[model samples]
Target: MRPVSVRYDNSSVRVCMKKKAMCKIGLAVMLLLTPMMGWSAKRLNIVIIVGDDWGGPYASAYTGIYGRNLPSNVVKTPNVDRIAQNGVLFKNAYVNAPSCTPSRSSIFTGRYFFNTGGGAVLGGTWDFTIPSFPLLLLDAGYHIGLTSKGWSPGTPRNAPFGGTAHYYQYFGTSVSSFSKSVTKWTAKGMPFEKAKQTMLDQVRGNFEAFLADRKPDQPFFYWFGPTNTHRTWVKGSGKALWGIEPDSLKDQLPVYLPNNPEVREDMADYLGEIQALDAYIGVLLKKLEEIGELDNTIIVATGDNGPGGFPRGKWNLYDFGVATPLVVWYPHSTGGRVVTDFTTLMDLAPTFLEVAGVAIPPKTDGRSLLNILTSPLSGQVDPQRTFAITGEERHNAKARDDSLPYPARALRTARYLYIRNFAPDRWPMGCPYVAAHVPYVFHDIGEPSPTYDWIITNRSIPSAADYFTWAFAKRPAEELYDAHKDPGQINNVADDPMYADIKKSLAEKLLAELKKAGDPRVIGDGGTFDRPPYTDLKTVACQDTIPLNWAPGSHH
Candidate 1:
């Protein structure tokens, strides 16, 4: 299929309204022409399948094939592949933030991370003032339910007076209880394949329960967050339990990581988790088809952020870190296409609202993708989607002086990526040493993993020191990468005089957008973000070296 050419101008609003008006007029004309048509507007069902820490390339549909010999193939996502084949696949989708909490917050609220205040930082409280699409859909009479993870890792501090309980009530029911009950069904004595199937069945069972309990005539919005790909996986289970060979995955390792047996083993395990998630998705799709709601439902499959536990991937602003896989299957609308326009996950919130015929809130920073989704053509349906911006604040504040966030923002265009680090002196990852009386330790990586341990142990070795630097070293204030020439983003071209013009242009564009969005960093109130009280007090440690007067306990 040829790539579709689209031109996006300032008249997007007018275009959208005109299209909507025409649709309404067409409906009215049809009714006037024939009363026997019996066409009634029906609410659409929404199902968002979000994977935790899953990268774009892991899905076979995105990478073009599913096999052990294929490069970058550690897992086969046939179910996810089906969604992309049957719907519109976004080739260039990025998260607002690389970390889970902040990224998910932006996705739910349709706002930028910095605009979310305390919610911008990891494990920080969510400001309830910002609207969530689910709540809006619920208010609009759509049955809403969430399984596994939701707006999580941090507490919703302002969720009415009842706190977390009230928050769950807003979603109708929390499926965590059901999830726990199903976990018991995975008996220890069961065979590996049977046990894995049982676990996947549990997830599907939760979704079935939600469907069974919903009002028959009312449409529904379901948020399905699977935790399969998260860290602390069953080590070597891919080989011992899942029958996946580590050798088969060696060639599939990410370019940023060393192509060794240990890394390949880790990748295989991760792929195992991804395959499990994909199987569960197949179950959900089958259920939707059986219930006769498949065609009426809007199914969206995506990831919160990039791969976790890998170097310069998760928790970093590199392309692999922030890029996500987005597949949208809106029945009776658009299908069998691919969109190359730059897209942010935040757009999903506005897209959902627009599709539901609900007004998008004024504070939303993301534009609706409804125009692109409904359009028959693919590729660049929205010409204005030429860039994607992502930022990062504090993430995993466990290392010494971790309260001092490594603040950074980045702008990604079709050919280049520009980043501006607010605090260049601090380590991009956590400080090498902890506050406690212990040897060199790094805690900012979020979870404990063999990949991280290998990097830390070999930091002093001449052969592996560069990898360590790439993973945890302090970065310069400005960084630029030629995306076309270096998709891996291994080279820093910011200091190259030849590319100064491009760098300056991207930097200015990013700053202008940030300022327009009322970002705290550009508006001169950025200090407030750094001063927000940490949700987990234990992660706080004194940062005496910071130039700012902010201290751990003193911020309060």
Candidate 2:
């Protein structure tokens, strides 16, 4: 297999795109006037703001109009929703995988999670063979920079996101631990509002510094990733900071989650973190506006994935786990349009390249969305944009006894959601216990929170029992759900005779697609990912090279 086309998915694309950009672009830089009315920037800038564990339906942009009864209506995301109002809001956007490393891997390489080899799982290293789009953009003479968490849980040897060359984080990244840091600040008699802003100022300061360092008329690509929306948020922060009452989410929760106070309050705190993320987004938006570059830049905002430490979220293949809120505000594009096209976060790579006039590298799976964004019409602009293929291999490597991955792939279509769990006997989430108490006993769901702890200790309670099984129990070999009928994805119809035909069709489609993508799981022995460096959970990444026997990109 010789790791087919490692160039485009990793560092090679950097070399190739740089040549293309150099040939096409002139050496001279053009200056934009400072004033808003007369600002004359030469090229479009790219700004991608990623939220940690943020989901699609959380924004008011999505829930404000529809899903009005949903829990997201408890909080308002004016800044994030503003991007929707000013541009196109994606109705369905998913990550290739749920875990942070793998999802970010897919987004970076514009390929399926499996194609990234060791990059396909958490605690996995960067497959240097995979080309990062941001690196390509940087190579093509785009002034690029990154702030906050870019790629995580693994050290990218090739410095996938430019290895701190364009990195700018002078103030601090304390905003990631939003509640904890804010608590520390406020505990010292700092005002709550000031304490919160004290953390958010890091976001503002770092972005401004990146902007300041950029050359005039140099089309820039900046990534702002904040993990505040992740777990370990302040319990009462929802009500105290954002005025969201936990009881307000009483009846709005999905059927998978208990509507009890402890659960509601925990979720409310998560929402508060989302609100905090929205505020940071507001800071970025304001900075762009101040520089008269708000409309000049192609602003894309989304989370790496959905919520963590929640039922059927993050580590699961469910929609809440994979689906991300995609809002793109292009300067000359139509606004207020909800595009229902099935798009993955991977698509942003090609979209950025196409807009920047940089040639997209070969062997990339992402299709450019420039056409859809530039179009005035909405809803299914591309008929070929029908479905998304999402899956997960491993979260915490030692999740299972042998460090085996719970390999699963899914085909999410317009009306149906079908999944095939290859390792059905193993826990889809991490194991109930681990070799050591590193990521806690329940490694995957180890983040300490009310809902997580409560579910663990009170799994036998009648009110919490069903959710426990729904969230943690090992899944069957196949699972099918009627998305139209059960939006929460609670009902599994894979075994139901009524859905027999549907299940068969979906399973076949998923397998064929995985095979075409050269997924190691569906090809040959399907044991490549099951072995080391992916299963080498002891280190942040594997030190040894992927042996020849563990061919990653083998194809038919």
Worst 10 residues of 1 by lDDT: 1-10
Tens digit per residue, CA lDDT, model 2, 1-556: 0111113544542244457665223221111211211114266889998888898458877784444377767778899889988899988889889888888888887888888777788867777766788876665566788888788877753257866777888989898888878877888899998987787789899998998887776678899888888877888888877788999998788788878888899888888888888889899899988989887899988988778888888888898888888899999778999998999988888888777655566677889998899999988999999999999888876667677788999999989999889989777766655332243335576465567666656666687788878888878999999988888898998899999998899898989988988999989999888888778634332112112232112210
lDDT of 2: 0.78
Estimated TM-score per prediction?
0.83, 0.89
lDDT of 1: 0.72
On residues 64-180, what C-alpha lDDT tens digit does candidate 1 reach at each position?
522223334556788888887788888789999988888988998888987876678777776766667776665455667777677667775423112333222223222222222
Model 2 RMSD, rounded to 1 decimal: 8.5
Error at 176, model 1, angstroms: 9.9
Candidate 1: regions farther than 4 A off: 1-40, 64-72, 157-188, 398-402, 434-440, 534-556
How far is 329's C-alpha from truth in model 1 (Å)?
Answer: 0.7
The C-alpha stretches of model 2 lying farther than 4 A from their native spots are: 1-41, 64-68, 434-440, 537-556
